[model samples]
Target chain A: MQRVNQTLGRIPPWLIYGIAAFPPVWFFWLGLNGGLGVEPIKELEHRLGELALQVLIATLAIRPLREWTHVNLLKLRRSLGVVTFAYVSLHLLVWLVLDVQILSEIWADIVKRPYITVGMAGFILMIPMVVTSNNLSLRKLGPKKWRRLHRLMYPVCVLAGLHFVMLTKGFQFEPLIYLALILVLLAARVPWNLGRATA
Target chain B: MAGRYKSDLKWSDVTPKADWINRRQLMAGSGALALGSTAGPAVASLGAQKTDWGAGLEPNTVEEITTYNNYYEFGTDKGDPAMHAHALTTEPWSIEIDGLVDQPGSYGLEDILKSVTLEERIYRLRCVERWSMVVPWVGFELADLLAMAGVQPSAKYVAFETALRPDEMPGVSYPIIDWPYKEGLRLDEAMHPLTIMATGLYDEPMPNQNGAPIRLVVPWKYGYKSIKSVVRISLVEEQPPTAWNNYSANEYGFYSNVNPDRDHPRWSQKYERRVGGGLFAKQEPTLFMNGYADEVGSLYAGMDLIENH
Candidate 1:
């Protein structure tokens, strides 16, 4: 356990951020070169959205990974959070600018479509957490208050999963699997918090 | 196996040189009758006549048209049918024409093709998903076949059904939808000169992915309205239950026309992305009745489209 943390601690979060940017860049290049298939805009949008959910799930798994497995990656959690936000933002940009290009219809869709409404809500909820993810903001807010505010991720994760589930045409299994995993992760925190409250 | 398909079959594979070089063999309905097993004058070769409907518009490339399709029996994804449709066997196909028709019997594909005059009818297909494509579909008018069947005066609607081969169609294994996909149109819509039963595209026989052997192409309506790999067509007095409408009556209506005013329950129909348009292409405003309102406007002149939609 000690060796795992010691080895991984030496790696800076900025390096992870640099590594994280590679996928979107590669996907953009593929979209440009016809490598992302005929419908590149849709492919790019789905890839970025799935990447965002994956990273966000990793953020939720960090504490459990350390406590259960003793392999700590707490140092990169904030960077991972930022990475998730970046990919989510890129996903929205592709949908707004490339997939659905009409300027007038943008706001209309965000208001009209149920899946878009849930997805936009999730994206908006991520804003404050990303802004407060910095060390300076952490110091200013203090540990207890910062932790409370960051707990907004629980609902954000749910909305993200729900957005994916609702977007699919039929009862697709893949998106439902994601939603189930997110719910399990969110639900796991409840009993521990309740036990602490009773004690 | 289904990540992305580069399409190993080239343009030559699609447009066989031998088929072109040997016109007599082509006319004789040899092994290379890519346009189904129709013989002689009944065979509708590609680019027969350029009418006003298809004057300025060019059909999408065979690659774009074939690769990106929505054959739900093959699978739900656009690329799925392209990847998995090869398993289907299209030879010795037949359709049962029944219901209120004067002549109700099982007609072999060759017999049906031999009866009708094949010609090119270029039309734009607007999918319910808000993507559009113009295809140079080579087929004959649906009215001609109905005329051969001798539609009874009591008939008010025409219902169509697609072949459901569970051994062949991967999608049928799962309960994703009700099997044996069905669709219907008003008697007038089916009888309209614009509606066609397509046999081929780009002068080649229909690919399995694009509903090989036979299919319906109602240009003004949404793509799903034109059922593919049709096996049973019935003339009935009442409107028939369509697959998508049965799935979600609130979302997918019986009409399923490409009307900009009537928005889908999930998305707006005001705009659509042209399928082959480049990655950065802008969304074009959707047309009313897919820009065929001039020809089909009279069909729905008095009816409430919004209510039907």
Candidate 2:
């Protein structure tokens, strides 16, 4: 059994596509099945939004988690980053398709609603992260510059959380918890050496 | 309680009087019977608050209270009530009227409707959640309904309770609150002419999610002050604990009046977005007494609104 497990674990990293696809696939299934309750479509829109934020945060933590644990999770980061983009695209699609239903209305809502403005800003920032996650693009931008570009995730997460807080009219504990979680993740990244030792 | 007017009150200090009228006379004239529910296609044709109804001193605004809702039981979203209340049983309901009243029994919803002569009142509904709706409610004034019950003067406040059915409302499954949501108003507020017991909107039966059968509509207060799907009304001397107050005492005051000046402990209460009117529509400054200063403002004349809030 131990030898069989080792053999299974040694399989090509791309074979792990199943695990990477699970959250979006499961949430999509939940949205379609009406498991999200009476306003399933709206719930889907919100979940896709939160999931986009979550995947971004998780992707941000990959370096810290790998460094702390001494476990190489290098192969999974690109797929996860792309998945974050996918969820964000879905989130924007829901607003465009279900909510605005018209390009003019979408433009109007984006301008009018503050939360929508912040959410759109976060989506726009994710474009570079999505583009730079590829191997060829990483070589083009260089590793140092690429890492700095991805650090935009910190502000993106904060803005995404702010977008959520603004959307909930009344006091909601869930968004606050997300905000707190992001803060701790950010706090963990405080550089003691300021990259002087690395340089 | 009185010296310099609180910075919030712009005009001279006006006492919020009870403005209580003869509940019995109003009830008798309204032409309702206390037995079976009024059966008809009354609500099938949804009308705006300002439609055709018999005339005599009608409220200037015809906002539909039944259509505008903040019943979070359906969901936290504004649109949840219309979508989630489909599973509710609005028909064959009963309200248990107890505590300090001469008559205490489980009265059928239909009987309550028939017993009172329904009037259409147009009033502004401001939600504590920062939204406003102008609803024209069709129902008898609360004073009219209480008159039929022969209320004893000892009843200083009226406590209202919503039906608690965990099976029907999934939101209640997780202790979002202590079930059978409760709210109360001072005897004076309860007896005020502006306080209504609405049964229908848009010329049709009230939708189940909007608190069908019978619900309180206190336009002067925030939307939550208008309790929905009220199953019980208890007249008591003690200050009753209210639902939002219990959930967060600091955030939701017992009075919950629609005063734009007295901010909720967390957020500013200066402005509200009117629903269906898309964003950027000029926000109307919320009135101190929800625009019922002429009718109910005198009742709280000496009370410090910020302290009460």
> What is the TM-score (0 to 1) of candidate 2?
0.62
**For residues A1-199, could you state the per-residue lDDT of candidate 2 as single tens digits?**
4454455446553554566567767766765543443234455678788888787778767667655765555556677778778888988987676544546546755776677888899889888898777789889999999888988888887888788887664456778888887777777777767854321
Among all candidates shown, the one with the greatest lDDT: 1
In terms of TM-score, which candidate is strongest? 1
Pairs that collide in candidate 1 are B34-B205
CAPRI class assigned to model 1? medium
Tell me how far the alpha carbon of residue B178 in candidate 2 is from the true structure, in angstroms, after superposition: 2.3
Pick out the ten consecutive residues of candidate 1 chain B with the lowest summed lDDT.
B1-10
TM-score of each model, paired residue for residue: 0.89, 0.62
Q: Give the alpha carbon lDDT tens digit for every residue of B201-226 in model 2.
A: 54457767668778899888988889
lDDT of 1 by residue, B1-309 (tens): 011113222333232434434543433332223222222344455543333346456556555676678887878877788777877888999989999999999989899887776766667889998888878677888898898899999999999999999999999886666778999999999988889899887666777888988999999999999999989999999999999898889889999888999988788999988876767867889999998898899999898999988
Write down the DockQ of candidate 1: 0.53
